[model samples]
Target: MTTSVSAIVIIVLALTALGYILGRQRALAVSDREKTKLHSLPGYYGQTVALYVAVPAFLLLGVWLFVQPIAIESQISSDIPQSIVDQSGAKSLVMADVRRIANGLDLLVGSGGFTETDLANMRADFSNVRSRLASVGVALGSDVQPAVFEAAKSYRNIGKAGSLIRNIAVLVTALALGAWSWFRITPRMRARNTSETFIKSLLMGSSLIAILTTLGIIGSLLFESIHFFRIYPARDFFFSATWNPQFRGGSDLGILPLLWGTLYVSFVALALAVPLGLMIAIYLAEYAGSSLRSFAKPAIEMLAGIPTIVYGLFALITVGPFIRDWIAQPTGLGSSSSSVMTAGLVMGIMLIPFISSLSDDIINAVPQSMRDGSYGLGATQSETIRKVIMPAALPGIVGAFLLAASRAIGETMIVVMGAGASARLSVNPFEAMTTVTVKIVSQLTGDTEFASPETLVAFALGLTLFVFTLGLNIIALYIVRKYREQYE
Candidate 1:
């Protein structure tokens, strides 16, 4: 059956190619025989025929592949004994066992360890089902029962028959469609318009899929978050100052402290990144020579390409110890190395390339005539840049900073490593704290039941974070658009 799917695909592709060639040849033949000009080009006729052969065939193949399994599972599920179902109290679990045993039997036969008659005579209770299956590399949880074995055998038989029937149907559909299109190809047909319309619809459908996928993600988060709020107090989730979740029960799950930590770290990162990155961008765009700019830009941008986990490791191993030893210990700020300062500093270093690269491009985009005009007004290069160029590029620069802020707020690894997982309301930058993203990871890490408040709260945190980032993006777009219309 696996091979049949691939074989059917190959046959459809071959038929499509044949349709294209025949359609082109037929169009040219009709044109020459009638001594008349074709309505559309010969290539358009070929494309129309190819689309007819490929599109409907592939669509049916996809639909059959999706539906056949559900139909088979339904028919086989009814055959499973009521005693087994009641004993397990979970029909889905029993069906899973049936599927596993069915696969094991197929493997056993394919391995040539048993003849077809030998397998047919084998009994689940009398035979060593576990050991025999393990010998064939199909592990089983327990000895198979008679009812499960019978169900598995029936499942395998029905699946084989369905696969055979599907192959025939797919091939017949492809050939029929191809022949119809081939015979319809004529010198006067509007093949170009039909093919172009199909392609346009295809592009529209592709774009809609992307938009629908984003909406689906938002819908899932909103739905689960609403479910979480129903069980837990929405008031406490939004406004409570404490964040402590107990798996057993009676825990305060708050977002205020986590939100504060997120904002504090992001603020520190922006404070560090904005000044230094902007300075670097100014020097690179306005003052640096051509040779220096060529060598420096890529070298600076390479910092952005490094994976966040590597930065996390660097924070954990190198930066954490150094900060704890000299800065925190001597200054009496805090004892812990993993603090807001630690994460903020590392995140700032990570954000440098993002701000610098984008700012550099925006600074460069300012026209040279503006600088000349500033110079003619008796202003120096530094004055011109500060007054004229910065204003012109301010909108784009603000957008870049917002993007960086979003990156800092959503960051997980650096915070997890450099900022210890301690959610607390603190003003001290050296104190250990955690962000919403870290707590989200902690909450969802192991075997978790979605119905529990402890687990469902992750969705709540995710929805809040999504809204925050989405708001930042919208504001950035508005600022950029408004100023772009004014300046450019």
Candidate 2:
């Protein structure tokens, strides 16, 4: 299949290039006083024509290829003996047998080798049919026996002719279109729009694919989670504090602990990130010299480029234990290094770039006129920023913060590794805990026991997360909208 697909692509590419070259050369040759040379580049015109040839033909090929196999299989089924066709369960077996038989027949017709099984099966069928025919021949006498052979030969001839006609029609249609497109490539015509439209259609089609994929993921989780909710009451799943999502039937599966843990870490992360990010952005936009800004801006933004898994590993190996011994132990909380404070603090560090980068861009978007307006009012630089500049950029700044929060809420690895596996509801940041995303990870990570409540809980958790994020986005969008109106 891959080889055939590759062959198709190669064939199309070659034809497109050929079409383009022909188009460009023709366009140049047909240049006259009325038409002059084309307004667009020759290459663009050629590519445009090439796309018309390649795109439509390739699409036709795909549709034909996909439909051909099933249609061919249906035709083959008509040739199967009535004995195998009568039994209901045996029908499936017979279908498989037919596929093998058809493949073998194709190979034989093509002068290709057959496996021993194929050879034996074909021989057996042929011998049995021949013996029956000979018996019938003997019963009827040789003078009248020609009709039986004629009937068998007629059925085979009809089937073969039908298949041949269909193939010929498809091939001829494909060739006609290909030739027509190739010939239509004249110096006068521009096909750039047609080519671009084809490409754009492919791109637009992909957007729906992402939406569908998300829906599929959520749907699969939703159904399984519903099964879980059926076994364990929804109230218990939502409100209960103690979390034990094991294989046992009576195992407690409350989301409260996970919820609390998620909020606690997110709170800690935001507390660290918001002010720090704002300050960095302010310094970058208002205070940093050009030379320093050039290097430092990228260096700070580089944090966002690092994978979350790397951040998780760093937290597990370095940050979590350091916090336990140095911070939490002195503060008198829990013994475990995997604490909410460690995870939250490290996660906050990971998010610094997200917050700062967004804040920086928004702050710069604030008009210089606002600052000048404040200065003209006899206000100091610091006073102007505090009173006017920051306020003007507040909507965009808030938007950035909310977006960053959305990212943190969905983050899996850092919380899973650094926030501990135990889903405890304690407020003390030093206590071991789990999160919604962490549990979602635990449920879906490897081969899940699909019917199990443990597995189903992930979906319910996901639906919760989705609803929460959706709400946040609505709030952010609303806030941004109001802010824009006010500023405008």
Candidate 3:
């Protein structure tokens, strides 16, 4: 099958290349081998031919590959008995075995281990089909049922037919389109215009894919959240202060504790990062010499390149214990190594580069004329920066801060290792608490039924986090637009 698919791809490519050469030669011939006599460049005619050949063929091939398996499965599923499905506890599981058996049979016949005649005549009770398949690298969970074996045979037959039909259809379409475009090439044809139109359509399609993908993600989250709300009351999910989820039943699935932890940790991180990062940005942009700034800026930005997991390890092994021993323990606030302050402080360190880099760029973007104008008024350097530069760059600086805040809010690894997974509504930063992301992970982990509230709650948590971050972005955009209007 792989060989056949590869052959199809190579053949399509070869045809496309052939169309390009033929189309170019035909354009030159029709123009009496004079370039200026043609309506467009000879290459444009060739490109137009190539696009017509490849685009429709590949599109048809793609659609066929995606839809054929689904059609085949739907048809074969009806042949499996209800008893087999009941024994597996899921129809999907039975279908999974059927697919495995079908692939194994294909492999067995390909390797000359069993003839198709022998496969058809073999009885499940006497043949030990499972062991034969296992030898060929296909492991079944249990003995193959006779009905499942029959279904597998049908699946393979249908798949083979679909593949043959698909390849023929695709090749026919490509040849038809390629020939049509090839013969349409004339000395007066607007090849350049048609080619440019195709390019523009391609660009538009790329943009539409991005927009549609975002919409698809939001749609999925919204649908799953709606399902969750139907099972659990919206009022309790929103207003209740507890955070507990149990698969057995009767769990207190509240948002308040997780929300509090998220906000509190983010606030601490921002409180530490914003002032320090802003100061670093100011120093680098205004005070530091070229040599010092060159070295210092890269060193600070390097922090952003480090993985979050590495930072989490640093928090767990180094920062957490230090905070517990030096601050929380000595101050009698809390004794736990995994505390909100530990995660926040470590996350703030990780976020420093993000805030500093963005703020520095924003500050530097402020027109130097603004500083000159301030200095011309007899103001000192500090006065010029305080009154002129900061205000000019305030909108962008706020945007950088909000972006950092969103990063802190959505963080999971540092919170998991440093702040622990005990969701609680508390004002004390020295105590351990968990955020929404951590709970979302915990709820969705392990093999659980998606129909249960416990698993569905992860989607609800994700939707809430999405909304919160989206609001932050909107606020940032509004501020940027408003300030740009005033400044301009």
Candidate 4:
């Protein structure tokens, strides 16, 4: 099926390319091979023909591919015996087995290891179908039931027919559209206008897709969070100080502890990152010489390129232990190597490049006339920077800090490795703590049902995090807009 789909794609592309060439030639021929005799350029006519050939066919292909499995599964699911569903306790799981069996049979037949007739006649009791499939690299969890085998065979047959029909339909559509568009080509057809309209539609479609994708994500989170809140009390979730989740039952699914840990770690991170990063940006943007600035800027930005996991490891191995031994242990703050301070410091290091780069660009964007005007008024370079430059760039700098804050709030790897997954409400930064992201990961990690409040709480946590970050972004945007007019 994959090979067949690839073949269809290649054929569609070939037809599109052919349509372009033929459409160009037809336009030239109709204009008596004179370039200026046509209403638009020859390329625009070719593009129009190519779009006609490719767009509808690809759209049809995409829709067919998306809808086919859903339609087939719905049909097959209805046919599954109620007794099997009762035993399995989940129709989705049973369907999963059916898919695996169908895929195995397809592989077996494709590899010439078994004929369709052999597969149809084979009995699960006598033939050891699981082992046969295992030989073909399709491992099943259990022995195949007779009913399931029959369903698998039906699934394979229907899938094959669907693929065949899909291929034929897509090819026919492409060829027909290509021919129609080719015949429509003329010396005065305004091909440029038609092509430009298609391009505009394509750009609009790309923007719509991005917008729709964001809405889809928010909708999923909102729906699942609603489901979670229905199961768990919203008051307890929001106001309770404890953070505990049990898989069995009766869990105290609170947000306060996790929220505290998130804010604490992020605060520490930003506290360290903002001052140092701002200084670095000031030096790079205002004070550093050209040679030193080029080298220092890239070297500082290199911190951003390092993987978060690598930073996590650094926190876990080097920074965590160092803090535990030198600072926490000596001061009697906490003994745990994985502490909030450890994660925060490492995260701060990771965030330095983000803040510095953004702040540098923002400060540089401050007009030189402001600096010259300040200097003309008997101000030193330092006074000019403080009195004129920083104020002018304050809005953009605020936005950069808010962006870095968002990044810190969403960090997971460093928290996992450095801050240890212990959710507690405390003022001490030297203790092990867990953030919303870490808890989100832990809650959804194991084999748990989505219907369970324990699993659903992850969505709630995610939605809360989303809303918090969204608020931050809104504030940043408002500040930038308001102050931007003043600066301009």
Quote model 4's TM-score.
Answer: 0.93
Q: Give per-residue CA lDDT, model 2, range 1-488, as digits (tens).
A: 34545655676677677877876776566565346756566676666666666666666666666676666556545655565456423344455544443333434434434343543343334454344434333221222222223333333344455545544554445456556765665545655665677679978877987998889987876777778789779998888888886565668888888888888888889999999999999999988999999999899989988988898898899988898888878877877889888889888998898999988988888888888989999999889888988888889899888987888888889998898888877778888888889888787765435556777788899989888887888888888888852333
CA deviation > 4 Å runs, candidate 2: 1-11, 22-45, 56-177, 184-193, 196-203, 206-232, 485-488
Can you tell me which runs of candidate 3 are displaced by over 4 Å?
A: 1-14, 33-36, 76-80, 83-164, 485-488
| Reference-based lDDT, residue 20, model 3 | 91
**Candidate 1, residues 1-488: lDDT per residue as tens digits?**
67789999999999989888988899999999989899999988888888888888888888899899899889888888888878765677788889988888888888887767877887896257777778788787766879998888888888888888888888888788888988887778999998898789878978998998899999999999999999999999999998988887998999999999999999988999999899999999999999999999999999999999999998889888889998998999999889998899999999999999999998988888899999999999999998999999999999999988899999999999999999999999999999999999999876455568898899999999999999998998898888962334
Q: Would you give me the overall lDDT of model 2?
A: 0.72
Whose TM-score is greatest here? 4
For each candidate in the order shown, give its overall lDDT on alpha carbons.
0.89, 0.72, 0.90, 0.91
lDDT of 3 by residue, 1-488 (tens): 67777888899999999999999999999899555589999999999998898888988998898899999999999878898988876687788888988999899889886898987887665258877887799887677788988899889888988999999998999999999999998999999999999889988988998999899989999999999999999999999998878787999999999999999889889989999999999999999999999999999999999998998999999999999999999999999999999999999999999999999999999888788888899999999889889988999999899989989999999899989999898888999999999999999887556678998999999999999999998988888878852333
How many steric clashes does model 4 contain? 0
| Candidate 3, pairs of clashing residues | none
Candidate order by lDDT, decreasing, is: 4, 3, 1, 2
Which candidate would rank higher by TM-score, 2 or 3? 3
Best by lDDT: 4
Q: TM-scores of the models, in the given order?
A: 0.83, 0.71, 0.87, 0.93
lDDT of 1: 0.89
TM-score of 2: 0.71
